[model samples]
Target: MSNTPIIEAIKLSKQFTKDGDFVLNSLSLSIPKNKFTAIIGYSGTGKSVFLRQVLGLDRATSGIVRVLGKELHNMEPAELNAFRKNLGVVFQDSALFDDQTVLENVCFPLKEHKRSMSEDKRKAIGSEKLKLSGLNEEHFNKFPEALSGGMKRRVALARALVLEPKILIYDEPTTGLDPVLKQKVDELILTTHKRRSSSTLVVTHDLPSALHFADHIVMLNAGAVLFEGSVSEFLKSSDNLVATFREQGLNKYGKN
Candidate 1:
């Protein structure tokens, strides 16, 4: 992997109107190219908010976010839209359209951005991604309402991969999965990253799973970076917050 940062945040800050303080304080971080980095923190620590800023879906109240070497907040709408074609995001909710068929949903990004491609070509690409996500042809015509939770998550992942993005972002990907399914998702992520070689960011509070796969980790506490290092460093560090999190996570998830 290269040393260049695929995503860089400089003094980023955010504050809601009703909140008295910054939900995300002045924080600077970088996600290196072709690496799997996990962002972990307690609830309400602005992990999702930080993701929104990186995605250019929300503007930072006081700093710069650069993705793929372009300043996100400063880009024009058309430019931002063009730039975003290279980013694939899997939301915490699996955000698939209930009204669309699985095939259509998987092909949505390609249809939106690669308009010149024929419908058959788009479906062909979507089919490839769906198979890669471990879904068979029989699942193609089903709607989101008809699928199981794990199936829906796989479809969402297929949709993300349809674009062949340079960066893949997962927001709480394993939130509601059972232990067995969670392992499947973890293996899926690791294998997908290996195949695609994308710079991936997983925003999750699931530390054991994060430690299982991540090359690096960034820990947030009270909206500030509490720790940043390799997985081994994160596991062995004596920092109070790291120790506390490690203990709690191990207790909850078991030492793996």
Candidate 2:
């Protein structure tokens, strides 16, 4: 893996209006290539806001976001599109097309991005990704509505990987699932990341999952980064806020 960060945020800040408080306050962080990092915080502490900035879906009020060496906010539209092809995102909601079958949903990206790919080739790639995500051929023709929550998550994962992106992102991936389903999804995430060797970033409120799976942790509080370090460091933190917050997470949701 490269020493350089695959994604870097430098002095980044975002505020909806001139007088509004910043959602992300001067945040500077780096996500190293081929590593798994987790961002954890309270619901309204700007975790999702920071994630949107990372994807260039939202522009920062100040500072820069660099993804794969390109400045996201400054990129030309065409350049950004090309750059985006290297990243894949799995949203909180599976975001599957209810009208489409699992196979079609997985093949959607290929159809949009690789227009020259033949129909057979697209289906072949989709099948391969779905299998990699722990789904078998039996589920291919099933619509998203016919699947369980865990199955839907697997389909979303398959779709996200269809493009073979180097950077994989998950936004509240385990949200709304029961404890059993949540564990299944968490294991799937770890397995998929290890198998693909992609740099992964997860923004989650589930602290136990983050502590169990992340190589590094980024904690946000009151619109600023309160801590950034290894899981061990976080657990042993001297900051009362960090320590207390961690205890709460462990107590409420023990590691899988």
Candidate 3:
């Protein structure tokens, strides 16, 4: 619905500053306006940090982060609070409160972002989102600890969608789940984009899902964009590094 690039990062770089050594090097990549972008890279490559920066959860050292064309690198506290609502990030942990019911977790965002919305309305919308994420009514009253890992991720997805965000950032959407449920997550990610048409950015190592769900793919190493192109282009890349990485071959990913 927005006539803006959902996310734009220009020469983005973040340093973890572990004894003055930078964990993340210069990063530069822009997400497609209205499509699924899968960012795949090896572990310890600042994938989570990159997502955090884009969602305004963390700040970049000396680079720019623009969401919907609004600069976020040095936004004030109030500005960050206002800007965070436009992006929904489903962390690797699902980040659900174990004390709360599934429905409560899903409605948390709506209540935070739209305080005036009635409780009944929020609950109804939450239920709808859960159903969309392949969750049934019976799961709504259960707490996070009782649910399986996949179900928790579904609740997380529902929560991410609760705000009707223009951008949904998924971090390893299919990790640690059973094969069947991994397929479910892949379908859910693809279906969410198809249904809402929201700009989606996925930070994942799920190569198969990345190849399947992504309209475009960006392969990163040491926070640098090593390969940027369509999924098909990625598969057909002539670069040996791209081929080796995509194929999960012997590449160690150190020379980004």
Candidate 4:
């Protein structure tokens, strides 16, 4: 990865046609190379859409988005796919196929992108990734339906890392897990960063996890950035909105 920023949005603006209203207006942000950054926002504040814009899945009505110094809107199809390969996303549902065994699921990205690899090699790579996620060999043959929610999320994480992506994006990674599992996921997120040296962008309202794992936090409200700073700076601020956000978020899940 370059020592420069991996991703940045310059004066980005997006509008939705819901009753002729605007959703995102003049929003901008940056993600430093090889660092984990967390994004938090009020409900329906367009955090997901912002993520989509960065992924090139959603277009901004104005402004430019750059990934690795390449403009997102200007990339060709082949270029876009190659560009996207550098990114890995962990969805809220885990997005694991229910019928496929955990091993097969983890191997899907390799099969889809590099069809020439031998099955043995692919399985070996998949198994190694699962092990890195704290999963044992016993999980290989188990189907998604057979695993617990936390286990399935871990399997999804293993799949995300199987390709050794340069950027890893996560959406509410701790949603359904119990306290123990939530901490496990948090640790896994941190470990992934240190082990892979991958830049991470996570969208979550889980304040404690965000504060603990993120080097920087950006808060979105009313479809635009409300605050951006280090976790300690945010916690120390006397702003009412920030205080309320911190209080509600840190308390909702009964965390500090």
In terms of lDDT, model 2 sits at: 0.90
Q: What tens digits encode model 3's per-residue C-alpha lDDT throughout 1-256?
A: 5555677778887776746655557777778788889988888877888887877778887788788888886689888887777787788889998899999999988888889999999999999999999999998999999999999998999998888888899888888888899888888888899999878999887777677788989888877888888988988888877777766632332222
Better of 3 and 4 by lDDT: 4
TM-score of the candidate numbered 4? Answer: 0.92
Pairs in steric clash, model 3: none
Question: Which residue segments of model 3 deviate by more than 4 Å?
Answer: 1-4, 249-256
Cα lDDT over the full model 3: 0.83
Give the number of the best model, judged by TM-score. 1
TM-scores of the candidates in the order shown: 0.97, 0.95, 0.92, 0.92
Model 1, residue 193: distance off in Å is 0.4
Q: For residues 152-249, could you state the per-residue lDDT of candidate 4 as single tens digits?
A: 88999999988888889998898878989998898998988988877998999788888888998899887677888888888897978888999999
Query: Model 2 over residues 1-256: C-alpha lDDT tens digits?
Result: 4688998889999999999998889988888888899999877999889888878888999988888888888988877777787888899888999999999999998998999999999999999999988899999999999999889989999999999998999999998899898988999999989988889999998898898899989999977889999999998899988988888888777542
Q: In candidate 1, list every pair of residues with a backbone clash.
A: none
List where candidate 2 sits over 4 angstroms from the true fold.
Answer: 254-256
The alpha-carbon deviation from the true structure for residue 159 of candidate 3, after best TM-score superposition, in angstroms, is: 0.5
Candidate 1 lDDT tens digits, 30-104: 888889999998998889999998889998789888888889888899989988988899998899998999999
lDDT of 3 at 221: 82
